[model samples]
Target: MVLSSPTWRERFRAGTVIPAHPLALTEQRKLDERHQRALTRYYLAAGAGGVAVGVHTTQFEIRDPRIGLYEPVLALAAEELRASDAIRVAGVCGNTAQAAREAQIARDLKYHAALLNLVALADSSIAEVVAHVRAIGEIMPIIGFYLQPAVGGQYFPVEFWRAFAEIESVIGIKIAPFNRYATQDVLRGVAESGRSHEIALYTGNDDHIVLDLLSGYHFSGCDLQIRGGLLGHWSVWTSCAVELHRQVRQAVESGKLVDPKWLLRNAEVTDMNAALFDVGHHFHGCIAGINEVLRRQGLLAGRWCLNPAEDLSGGQAQELDRVIATYPHLVDDQFVKQNLDTWLS
Candidate 1:
């Protein structure tokens, strides 16, 4: 039973808490195939609507010439998720040829779409970026990304997104511009392009996940809203993230919106993200912090990143410890621990 691109977009809007996957590694920094399967199985059982690999959470380590982990990681995840009903999105970056090749590889491996991270071509003009996206669209549908600058975010204009939205191959977007103004700009373009319904809007806004999901926008005579989340923060405590999405979706369906209890929970999640991301350290500690939680659950052996220097910041471990202690229920470590052996098997 193969799923088409549109089926994948429907899943994206249907509360698919697509957490960007962190590459699992052995202590020796080699790809851990066992852990990779474990992570995919965990997300599937946890009810993640989809899973994204080769993204920021997976680290740029895959791209390093010396390590060259890109192929193995995606291949492993694709094999693990080959039968999944959930959407499979592989991150695509670099210049047009590189991105096109990545998209081709993902298609060959049966991924449904590309989470197009146009960040690598930071200096490329709007036309160049559009050209790059158009080239990859030849291979698969694109989930356009507006990543934050702390991680080499691109400053794409509304005009650029308007053109992108008009393209038949651009089926979804992860709006992580990480700025209210920039996010609205993309929304306006989508609305104006008269393709709001065609393009699934997934928020990567970790700071405003609740608001982004619940708040409906009025732009260009079109009503627009974020469908779900594709977040790095959701990588940890995945089942809880799925539950949170269910709660939020229930709220949206109920019509009596703005429930105070859910609002508080959202803020709590943000605070936990601040700790997990190590906001004080400019998010340099984020991936390690996620792995740290997985490590404790026995899903991973260590917080080992491909880059030697990519470990946590000075107080990141302490910050993670504090967050875990403070929000014991939020971590959902018990659920993973209970199913750890099963998922590993």
Candidate 2:
């Protein structure tokens, strides 16, 4: 089903933090249903607008037949989301047939939209990729993803984004190329698509979240803003991320000169992400790092990933400790502490 309700569309356009929900796995690398439900509760309690499940942060391996977690995970989140008006997004990946099947699953589960990952179409031409996207859009409302090359993402120039945005079912785009120039290309493409007003822009750039929210883009006579975030960085310390989004929205809506402090805080947040994402090791520990934070807060049982080899990098723990101590205000330990039991229940 598409986003047919004006209220739902308005809520999405109004902009709020939408965390890339993480998988809570047991020490045996199995899904911990209790902790998983608690995570959905935690994001809602922390004031997130919604959660994106089955995404990279949720572990792409969930789609593996041996594991068979894709449907169960999405169903769990959809069940929790039913009681609230919060937007529900499911991550859809793979080629035309595979992505369409995933989109159908998300649609069957009542997800409002599918965040389409095009990594599987990397070898296809731009036309073929757009065809694949259009095929998925036929099954569900689409949110385009420009994932970073450091992961499985492939580069698509301005023309490709313009065409992608032009698709009738496309409602949003997450610009997370993790490069300034690449991010700008998406802004330019969407602006030029003449459907800029129809599509909501979200920052997936973990390293540049604050500035992306605070800044605006002018291209081809159209002005645009990064309306919100669909971030893995937001999976942890989400209360703080929600507050930061609110502060940025207030500053931008005020239309006055932005305080220099916000700009300075941008650097601080980047430093924090460096540790959380393990930029030192090219983000090898990114998922584990996020899990580590939640584990420390008692939100997660442990930092176990489906892949046995995935764990925190050397000194990554030290870095996390330093950031936690240095940036006390950036975390929500107190918030998590107050309601951890309630969420777990």
Candidate 3:
């Protein structure tokens, strides 16, 4: 029986288009409780309908060394969200057992769903991957993930996505293959699954945000539309991202074509993403760049990360500075500054 209310699809339709979650850290390379809570408040105040933690943006610090911040950080987010209407989505990765344990932690902490990352199954057959997802479905409601190869990508045939969608507990999918074909593969899988309405598709593709949101995917049987984003890119310039997302959502939901200026805005978001994600360095500095945004706003003392290899790349700051100066409308730094103190207090 379905135990969740409003379901994941309903939540997406109700203006949760931009979930402005951020990577978690302080300059000390640890969970910054004050900053963590501040980030949560900032997302809500900035118009995010929900928040996600424990995903890639949060760093693998929680588990890579067993630093034990997973539950604490998730618990902190849960506390901050308790009084609000925003739903909480906690990310779960690893093998079936590990994923289940992590998911249980999220459920026990009162998260609404799990962002299921089905990776490290490269050697496993499509059938095996489908089985793994089904096993996890028994543990909690799932949001399927299609991560890019640059970041521990996983591959399952289009058929696997079709089978996975038929699972009663799966609610959404975050497609970020960074490949249009593979992205289309998943979309086609859902369209063919005969359960299109049951599963929501969210774009994690930082490179193709506007088109993903604005362009409806047509299949022989059914049409699939990307609901919105569950992206690391949104971690920066959050308030403006929230507004931009809402505007896009209104147009798409109303079946209207947005102006060219709106489409052009995506290039700006991508520009900011390039600097924040450190695309120049193959995204090695992604986490650090996100922390840098917070650091400038006083949320973090430095751009520290769990993996030094993933730390800020040389010249990334110069690139970020250039983007910030040239593309003022692309960031919400001022909004963050205006509410920083209130959030911290």
Among these predictions, the greatest lDDT belongs to 2
Q: How close is candidate 2 to the true structure, as a TM-score?
A: 0.98
Pairs of colliding residues, candidate 1: none
The TM-score leader among the candidates is 2
Query: What is the overall TM-score of model 3 with all chains considered together?
Result: 0.94
Compose the digit string of candidate 1's lDDT tens values, residues 125-240: 87887887888999999989989987789788889889889888998889997799999999999998888888999899888888888888999899887878999988889998
Cα lDDT, all candidates: 0.86, 0.93, 0.81
How do the candidates rank by TM-score, highest first?
A: 2, 1, 3
What is the Cα root-mean-square deviation between model 1 and the actual structure?
2.4
The C-alpha RMSD in Å for every predicted model, in order, reads 2.4, 2.6, 3.0
lDDT of 3 by residue, 1-345 (tens): 878667544886443544535555655567777878888888889877788889888876677655777788888989999988787889898888888889999999888889988775778887887888888788778888999988788766788888888888888888898889999999988888888887888899998887888888888579788877898888777788778887887888887666798678778877888898888999888878888888888766667776655678999999989999988876787887778899988
* Backbone collision tally, model 3: 0
